[model samples]
Target chain A: MAEILTAKKLAIKVSICLAVLVAVMALCAMVGTQKISLKKVFAGPGQEPGQNIDYEILVGVRLPRVILAALVGAALACSGVVLQAILRNPLADPYILGISSGAGLGVITAVISGITWKFWGGSPIAVFAFVGALATVWLVWCIGHLTGKSQVTSLLLAGVVINAFFSAVIMFLISIAKSEQLRSTVLWLMGNIIEKDPAVLGVSTVCILAGIIALFSISHRLNILTFGQEEAKGLGVDTAKTTAIAFGLAAFTTAIAVSLSGLIGFVGLIVPHGVRLVFGPDHRQLLPVSAIIGGAFLVVADTLARIIVAPAQLPVGVITAIAGGPFFLVLLAKYSRKVSWLK
Target chain B: MSGIIEVKDLNFGYTPQSTILKALSFEVIQGRFVGIAGPNGAGKTTLLNLLCGLLRSKAGSIKIDSVPIESYSARKLAKKVAVVRQEFVPVFDFCVAEVVSMARTPYLSTFGFESDTDKKIIDEALEMTDTARFASRPLANLSGGERQRVFIARALAQNTDILLLDEPTTFLDLKHQVGIYDLLKRMQLEKGKTIVVVTHDINLSTQYCDEILLLGADSSYQYGSAKDVFSPHKIEKVFGVRGFAGKIGTEKFFLPLGKFAKDAHIITTNINSTTKK
Candidate 1:
């Protein structure tokens, strides 16, 4: 009977998530530059043979951007789910371990130094971002190990220090940058979805997808980890190795998302928490649902960022921040009293 | 050699300069209920950690079913022993059933899906722990005693032969403590589980445990039946108090004795009459 109830709950959650995804995708497709009809949107960017321009605009440009936004959003949200579980902190996000700042630093460094080598004519920024994110996470791990206190607080504090230091270095680089480079760097900080080269998008998708798969595969371990490290170990989880892998995957996905979308925040922090509130904290459900909802949320946010001001696009980061800030405050107002569990 | 758990000359510490456990050796016979007692920092938790392979011993060896503990992988060890620690903080608002299902993790594959047998085990653990009524309730909403029971339920779901509990009654009131002890005793007797509990409540330990291990500073340790280990002399030596043991309603209790005031006069005849009564 309990199993039946759980199955029903899971089914309800999946259906709701699918419904939300469909609604958001439809909204995203219908609200763009031309305000295409639902029929046109559903028929999917191609109807007649001669009218290739509309098809190209719809399929080539808008479709990829929306798909990329969804993929990156899902990746970030799922990474947040795993990280929060492993750290045993509700406030933990993909960026809490310094992945975003590290990737940002790498991108800024590459941009400032004019190191523009492309792998198969793709953006070097994504590659540099991933490498930098992994390197910084390793550095944080080493520091934590050297100190012999790898507690969550110590790791978080280390990330904060590294984030601040990296931000300062990136700022210094920006200060010395030429006008064109400085403008690009500033715009990158604001985050944009335009000009995503196909090759860059493909590589970023693959990286994010791999990280998502790795994380989802260990969803059960992630759930056990929420009981804290010692209990998790008692339950036979190799706490050290599993934690490292989960953190690495979260960092990797966040790095790819940051590289592709340029520091889209709050989606990683908000979407998973929201999903948990609705579906409860079973990672087998939470991870995948958070991913789907996160993808849909970002796709809608990106669409709004495009159409909100027309012709001139607002930065996707700004929209997420604006949306997530209020959502987070509402969350705090509702759940802050219950956070004594942290004690 | 036939015991479920055996530790020999086990020495462990956080650092070389500060040893917590020194040559600690004990055996828990199959299906025995053993209690470990000591003052704070008596290395009770460290010893339990060593037994469960949560912390590697610096010296000596630990064996489960005559196999070197270090030789068993974490999953194998978990299948043999489950620990309910003193501090259990759930990071998420998981339902009680979900929390209980986590105990089946050791028996599951890498994917860790709950099989029909696994679900039955979880249900049984929940029912055994008296948490089945709140199976749908969020764990965060449970009282401290309830949450502690949920942790135990999760451990029970592991279905191990040995259960190690560290200060399981620390935060509970007297009623809850007795309830938990009674539940643990039932589990031991009914399931034939080898149970080891670490606690500061010597009286409770003496009442419930078949064997008691007393740990003290300066590399001192004693292991025997509760009657043998909880004598007045050993109690005074360990607690630095003059204590009197007496029976009340078929239960034994130890109470600290105090010296009379210097200005007060003791009446020997009255004392003899009171004792006779």
Candidate 2:
């Protein structure tokens, strides 16, 4: 019908998704291994120590973890949407930047070297991961630009090579490490949501939110980029500059997420596909909508991980890989009768 | 005035040892339908990419309306030219209107917001291409011909003065082939848009183009009206197969001849001298 996609319409769509995110976060916060009352949240703030364990559990432990899941979810999914567009590969997920392997190498090296795993407020692994992942991405960036032309193909090739090399190192470390260290390393690789310093959450929240806004600003150019490199240039996009901007923003956000959430899988891979399957692939809607839905998907996954084991929590990453894969396939099977995954 | 598009001494290759186009020179006047026809690996597509500024040449210059192409910003150039690539199947399945809306990228504000005028232009493009019937449908739902038409509609939505296409007929049958060529011809005639197509279909180009630029192996080229440029010997030399030229209603067509044909000498016309330009 050639109806106008007015500003009002875009706002409404995003608002609806935001509403759903809020609903999911609220529901997940209510039902954890430990019973918490929503009434406590509305009741007057706890002014003294030894305030009800219910208040401490809800506000300190459960609520922060749920919020962290949402933030990481949003970051990974948003990165997935933009990366798929610019890289011209639907198989590109947050980990395709080699973030998981980079982070994995950090965890494995620290464990194998006999560095205490729980020191620095249980953040030594997170610190190592944040540095290693960012360093690997920086290495890929330099390699992609060695010819003074940072082509997406060059960047992608660099990522693949770096990912393979780092993963091999991680596997070698795991194979030779002692049993106790290997156990901790494996748990770190599997990924989980844990309570964090308020400062870390606040800083990550700012970085990720800014990254989403930056990506949203460039979504229109990304639509043209899907037409391949030469063709995108033919359409008058400054392919080099636009690609650089999108890649840098998406990469930084993915690094921040992995540093915070340790290596949550499948949210980055499945959320964007599910969102694209539901809403068509227009980046204008796809970016924000995928981000909101990605947050909710992870919250639900984390909540189920908390309860399914009942007093013994599973890593949220395991639930994402286990539950999200079948759920995505079901969606694919139901909808693929109409349209293909990609052609 | 020479033409709306001009090129001189253009050279390009992925590397110095593998040059694709060598000192290529050509021009297309405004409102003319020009076809770039050539054999495989002869740089037809490379030349097209050079024309649109997708790839820059190291040796020479391309100009639009006497202004060097490098001087034009990407957005400014996009308003003057729109390109329809060969079989561009994107990873995601955007609907017809959604894909068409992308053509307005160069025209949108820095924030990429659309105005009423952009919507009107999009609507008109759909109507012109006859794709408005399935404007709401996903591109996957359309037939081959319909999808090609939708791509053309996207180009038209750019509202450019010049349009370029690469093998719009690939993977299409005869009817769709004719339909696509007809659409391009109509655009040239009715809308006064300069058109250039790089294609392997020499026969169809012979019927539709005002001028033909036949590129051959080793950088040799012949540019003239189809009548002046096409001949059985040239076809055999370029494509490495013998062919006979047949005439129908002022239009010439080529039919390849091989040793397998029965009694091929009897029907041979030896019309090379008769067809001399």
Candidate 3:
């Protein structure tokens, strides 16, 4: 009887919080830099008496940017949850695993070498980033598996080494790049989601949605995996296949997010940890709640980023780093004893 | 197909030459509580892993109910066998109920929500293990013995016919150790669970287990009824210690005299003198 009540209460809480988030997002959409009235926002395409200007700024500029922030935030948080569960470490994130560096390298390669391709109206940068992320994940898995068993310590050390090496290579590429390419690369590496292209937004939306759905589908297997690989296998999880699917989808979502915006850090690491602290570690609830909260959190952060400087926006990544750095330190201190990878 | 296991001439090693368990064979009847006992590095845990197909044998075979262990998928095999490991500390804060509910993973859908049936089983498991009171508490807050029982509750929720435990009493206190053995014994008799436990407590095995397999040096094992296998000669020879087996009110125990004596004559005289009593 008590169990049922707690579960019901949690469900009610989540629903209420989601509704509140929707309202917050709506208010934020209205209050950014210029306060456009609902009339102008809904006025459609018109050239009469400031109609086109308000509509373009509200619908074309602000709405898409907000939507893109929500999508990328949800993607990063979901990726964090999956990586942390699989690696059995609280500190495992796309950025920590060298995945973001790998994706950044791919984007730089595309930018400097003038190698471009378009897929389903998404930029060539996203494709290169996705390929790079997947390749790095595969390489890390291989290195971690050299002993025939993928120990958590080995996987973490391999990630650390790969992250360092990939970052150096990215720096080398940045040094030789043209001035325009360098600025673009720098902006991307610092993380910003100013892309106003509807086609790219549409592609990213579909991919992030599909990736979250796929992640939610495997959340059960991920719950078992948190007990570690051997126990998960004993409980009947196909550890190898589940790991592959999870890494693949997480990398795909992260690649899209990284390419859409520059390498945003900490949203993935912080959101899931915050969610776990509040909701406990049942992945069924963890994945979805984290996704929702992550989206809302980023919407708020990006809003702050825009308004903080008044016409000169600070990158959202800067805000997350400032906030999440101390939180990461606290978590490291708390969990270092239990998690060997922390050492 | 309820808990009958057959292992034949299994061989395993991390490397080619350094074999752990070689040419091993054993058969377990239905509904028996068996204990695997040995000194350190006897490959008892390795054998348990092989039984559940967590570790593949380099040679020979293991069959559960006349089917090869490899024939069943990991998920399918989990429906028949559940294992409680010695060491598992979750990195995140999973409450006791949530950890126990993870046993329903094989039965859950892609989204992994627990159904009504899964909930009932989880409740029953928690109640049986006496972990229902701490259902809302984070597992990290529990004491070692309480956490151990919670793990047992998880394995119970798995609802497999065969339950395997690897050193379930490692970090537990004396009372908790006996409590766990008593719980397993009750399940063996009342619930008819086929249990295989790897324990270093030879006395605990002798008091409760229906049969005990004593692993010896050179990848060998001696298997029989507890009464047949717990003799002083076999204990001393296998464990490399001087021990005398004695019974008080039909409950047998082995008391180690000391490490084997350096003088062969003194060892022989001592063994001969103790056996005469």
lDDT of 3: 0.82
Clashes of each: 0, 0, 0
Model 3 reaches what TM-score against the true structure?
A: 0.92
Per-chain TM-score, chain A, candidate 2: 0.92
- DockQ of each model against the real complex? 0.53, 0.54, 0.54
lDDT of 1 at B49: 88
Task: Report the lDDT tens digits of candidate 1 across residue range A1-343.
Answer: 3331244566688788878887787567656677544455445544666454555666667878887889889988998898788888888888887787788788888788898577657667767777888788888767656654557667777878888888888878888889988877777777777757777778778878788878877888888888777888899999888988988788778877877878788898899888777566789889889999999989988998998999889999999999988976787677655444533
For A138-245, candidate 2 gives per-residue lDDT tens digits of 888788777445467787888899999999989888888889987878888888888888778888899999999999998888888987777667667888799889
Give the per-residue Cα lDDT of candidate 3 at B11. 90
lDDT of 1: 0.81
Scored by TM against the true chain B, the candidates give 0.90, 0.93, 0.94
Ranked by DockQ, the better of candidates 1 and 2 is 2
Each candidate's interface RMSD, rounded to one decimal?
2.8, 1.7, 3.9
Query: Model 3's CAPRI class?
Result: medium
For model 2, the interface Cα RMSD in angstroms equals: 1.7
Better candidate number, 1 or 3, judged by lDDT: 3
Isolated chain A TM-score, each model: 0.89, 0.92, 0.87
lDDT tens digits, residue span B6-91, model 2: 88888888787887777878888899999988899898888877778777788888999889988988878888888888765566
lDDT tens per residue, model 3, B94-149: 77888888888888766656778888999999998899999987777788889989
